[model samples]
Target: MLIALSFAVGGLLHHLGILRIDHLPPLHAHFRVPTFRLLPAAVFGLAAAWMLPGALARLRFGRAIALGYGTALAWTVLLAVSGDGLAAPFTHKEEYLAVLPAVGDDPSGWLAGFTEHLPGYPTHVRGHPPLPVLVVWALQALGLPGPLWAALLVVLVGCSAAVAITLTVRRLGGEDAARRALPYLALTPASVWIATSMDAFFAGVGAWGVALLVLGRKRWSRLLSGAGAGVLLGSLPYLSYGLVPYLLIPVVVAVMVRPSRLTVAAILAGAGSVTAAFAAGGFFWPDGVLATHAQWAADPGAARPYLYFLFANIAVLALVTGPAATAGLVGPIPARVRTVVAATLVAVAALDVSGVTRGEVERIWVPFAVWVSVAGGFAGGRAGGHAGDRRWLAAQVVTGLLLQGLVASPW
Candidate 1:
């Protein structure tokens, strides 16, 4: 119902000429000639939806992580291949790889002048920090070059977000909640973007940062885990300016866990180290934010009507999260899980109302989307019961397959 309403609203806006999107409303995608390529993924998703919920209930924690991650990875790859083949990651003109050649051999020099050269770069490059391009550039320097390697790196790392989210849920809500959430995390509609978009890489990194922070609250590994979380969280701003709002996620984690002062200090030290290193390399975080904001404001796409997207963005979120998550939002969730969901929503709402992210949130907000979708784990009966869980999981899988078959997205 929410999904249909979103499209209907988007269609009306498009018809009225009030929406400035280049592609279809509510999504940055076009209707494609339907293809049989989606059939294999459909079959796989149905099988997992039917089987994994029960199997995950009985599996050991270690084995569950392995199985869950492997299944999620396979699902993302199949969906991505179904849409654009192995070349999907680099296919878009605005993607990071498209502008990799522009970075040249002098990374330090480029980092120093990133803001000055921002306007001349491609759309995706100009709108983001230097980290994404730097990752691709590092791959090339390591002899693991080209779009295929970059795409593989992204999918591999991106799919791991499922594991990270699962771990965080387990820490906060217990093993049952974590186990229940696994299928949704693995089979989310968000996988459509996670398969090919660089934003998926950001989602994975941000999720693990929170996961580590919660997991690190223990006495033995506080320093190591806090430091790890800090570095990953700190690096997020450089990945996407939009992720600056993502700080709320970690703040929520910190409050929930109530870490010792040493743990907190370790986190600050780790984050400060990244800030220092970047400053030494000439890419101050504040400059990147200002420059990206300027670039975004000047882009014609930013001209879309804010009034329409203010609501339509929620619709796109529904599409990405699917019915299970939507239902879970109202279900009886654990306080910790609910708190995390609330924090993510606050961040997303802040972004939506700010008029900075007018559309394409289906891909751009992947990091927050995963957390929002965590509500799905609580939608069914208590941890051990299968009651309504499988049905909702099936709905999520079908939603992904339908989206892949029906629309051709920019990712």
Candidate 2:
């Protein structure tokens, strides 16, 4: 109903010329006629949705991770191919690869002047910090140059976010909860965007950062985990300023785990080192944010109606998370996991009203979307048995396939 209302109201506003959504209302995509190419992904998704819930529950933790990650990778690739082929990652002129040549051999030099170059760079480059381009640059440096390799790299990292989310759930709610959530985590409508967007890359990084922090709260591994989380979290804002809201996730984890003072220091140290390195390279994070804001203000897309987007953004979120997550949001969530869910909702609400994120949140909010999808686990668990779980999982899979087949994403 929320999704329906967003589209109805948003479409009305767009038709009335009061809202300037460039593509579709609530999504930065257009309608497309799906071809025979979609059949393979559709078949695979249905099979996985039907089979994965039981398998994830019965398999050992290691095997479940393998199955979940492998299936997610295959699903994302198939969906990407079904919609736009392998070149989809670089097909858009505004993507990071188009701006890679500007960096040349001196990444440090590029980082130093990133803010100054914002006005002239393409849309994706201008909006983000230096990490996305640097990631592709690093891949190129490693002999994996060109769009094909970059696309594969993005898919590989993006799919791994499922593993991270599964681990976090296991840490917080126990193995059963993790297993219950694994299928939904592995099969999500967000995979439509995960196939080709840098936002998916950010989702993977942020998810792992939070996962490590949760997993690292033990006495023996606290320092190591905290430091690892710190580096990933620290690098997040550099990847995309919009990801700043994700910082709240770790705070939720810390409160739940109650880490010692030393662990806190380690997290701070890890994050601080990344900040220090960027500063040394002549890029201050705050100034970069200000510059990006100015660029965003100048972009014509900023003319989008905020009042409409406040609810429409959440509508896109519902589409990405699917019906199962919606059921979970209102269903009986476990006490331990409730805080994480609450934190995620609060973050999304904050982003929605901030006016910084007007639309296209389907992809931009992928990080939070993963956590929100965790609710599907509880929804499945309470739905009776494995059959109920499979039904919910299938719903999520169908949502992804339908979106991939029907929507032509700009990414």
Candidate 3:
């Protein structure tokens, strides 16, 4: 009942919020009711997620990770078939192509891969860092062809993140929490965007990196996990400028979960070393930050008013999280990590309202959204049972499918 009311109120607010704003973009061109064409694919996503729990329970961790990857890939392929045909050619392949030469031309792989190679990187690649671009180059170098490989690269990223989320939850909250959280993480309406966006790769690496840090003190290989985590935590700053904010997760997880002093120090050292490496490569973090604004100059979405989109983005986030998790946002949560998590969400909200990331925040905010979705699992504790219903979960799946099937925004 509370979930239903929250969705109703959210819908009402979106409608009322848009009415007060003038010069709003046309929704019709972007969003429409799909005909029968894509319905099967939409239905498939919901069904697969619903049925996954039993299958996941039977598999060990290794198989479970593979299943997560294959499921997401299949979901992406299904979504593509439903909308743009199975090939779903990468729309932003140009960005990958533009940065490929920098990787190929550089003699010292580490130095050139870390630096942005200014005056050479077409403006399209300027605002970005080199990690993902290098990954694209690596894929091509390995003989993977065209946009198809890039598409697979993104799928791998999202799948890896999904597996990372499962492992992290199991480490911190126990298997029950891990089990409860997987469905929300895998099939939440955001999977639609996960299917197409490179941000998923960023989200995957950053997420696993943090997961390693948090698990530093767990029974398994504390030295190895902490060491790797430190490197990941440090390299995050170089991945994407916007991703800098997400560094808070590792910081908060470290504090709340409490790793050993050595683990924490290693994390700091890893970041410092990576920073030094990037400096030697001739690209400084400050320059990357400045380049972001220049890159946004060509972004059409940036033109939208923040006030209107702030509310709209929240609506999209609510849908992305789905009805059950959306309801969880309002409910009570475990206190130990609540303050930090809430603060993170509040910070993201403040950033959105500031107009810095005015539009397409639903996509840009992927890393933060993954954390924010944790609220749903926490809410389940407050409810004395799980917070989400399978039916509501299915409803969430439909919301995402409709977004792609109806609006077909190629972001």
Candidate 4:
């Protein structure tokens, strides 16, 4: 039924003229190299064999990491190689790719004049904050090549997010929750874009920052976690204007779960550091963030009739989240985590409806999507309890990947 539902959704998207056919470019032709196509399958087969012992029984943290990133890399690389073979940008990667060479040439000038560089409303460069550019610039400085570096950075950040999600679940629930959640994080339909966007890195920083704050039950840990969360959360608005709303999630978690004066103080201080730095650099948060909307409002995609893609993206988000986990969101859970999760969902839903994210939310809503997957751990049924349940999730991911690969839509 879920498979059919996914196909139906894809069919509907095709009918709507959203998905189109494309001729394979010379660069993407290498994916047709028969040997290259076989490699990902071989890698996955070996990983499943290695992880079978741990996955079926204890699901240890180390094995979970292996399963998560191993699966993530296999799936992501397969998608990338299949689509473009790492030669051309994958869906919206141009946004991040545009800024790197400029940043590499003059980091200070870029920082000071980033807002001024926005040629118009919805300029690709204005689509995200400057942090990703700095990170990519540093990678380029270390001799990594163009666009490939962007891809690698995104994959690394995404895999780290998987680890952070595991840790957060371990803290809130237990090993069982963490174990059940890892696979979902690893192979969600979102993986198609995880290596293509700076949003994945933003999701990682935000996930770990909040995870540390909520999971740190010890005093010293709380101090460090709080401070780290503050810095990341503080940096969120700088990452993207859309992310400013997410600051509420960590703030609520800190206040509700582990309210300590020192933790709060550290958070404030960590936030202050970025604030001070950006201020020193002449980019005030309000002024910079407010300027993003001009491009957003001006972008043709955002200017389209909202209802056309609004419901479609919502449907895609649900499918990408997997049917079981989507079902689980409304099911039972521990009160504390449930509250956090529910609040996060409300924020995400509000954003979805506001037309700010008119379309492409499967990639755009990644930061909130991780939390939704985590919250699914608390749902009524035992996660992955049914026999062949993992197969079902795998099928969901595979189906989505095929749809994405076949479609000409840009992420």
Tens digits of per-residue lDDT for model 3, 1-411? 433453354446446664222222222125556767677777777677567666665677667657766776667567666676532535454455555655675635634544444435654366567666666677787899566778777767765676776777676666655665666666666666666667767778888887887664454477678778878767776767777777777777777778877766776787788888777766677776666665666555455555655665666566566665666665554454455457567757766666766555556777666666655554444334422435555665777676667665545
Q: How big is the positional error of residue 49 in model 4, measured in Å on the Cα after superposition?
A: 12
* Model 4 lDDT per residue over 1-411, tens place: 544554465456555655432122100111223335535633553354345324634655776667677776776666666655543553354566555656667787778887787653124567766666677678778888577666777778775787887776666666666766676676666666665667777888888887878766688988898888888888887777778677777877766666588888998999899889988876777767666776667655554445645555556566556554576677655556666677777777777677787656667777877777664443436544534444545454654455445543343
TM-score per prediction, in order, is 0.96, 0.97, 0.81, 0.82
lDDT of 1 by residue, 1-411 (tens): 665777888888788877756467888778887588888898899899888988888889999889999999889888988878755657677778777677778889888988898998888898889999999999999999888888888888888988998899888888877888888899999998887888988999999999889885456698899999999999998898889889998998899888889988989998898899899999988888888888888887688888878888888888888888988887778789889999999999998999888888888888988998889877764642565777888899999988888888878
lDDT of each: 0.86, 0.86, 0.63, 0.64
Candidate 2: give its CA RMSD in angstroms.
1.5
lDDT of 4: 0.64
Candidate 1, residue 287: Cα displacement in angstroms equals 1.7
Pairs with backbone N, CA or C atoms under 3 Å apart (clashes), candidate 3: none
Error of 1 at 408 (Å): 0.4
Residue 6 lDDT in model 3?
38
Error of 1 at 159 (Å): 1.2
lDDT of 2: 0.86
Model 2 spans > 4 angstroms off: 19-21, 216-220, 381-383
Off by over 4 Å in 3: 1-29, 32-37, 53-70, 85-94, 107-124, 216-220, 297-303, 331-333, 336-344, 377-388
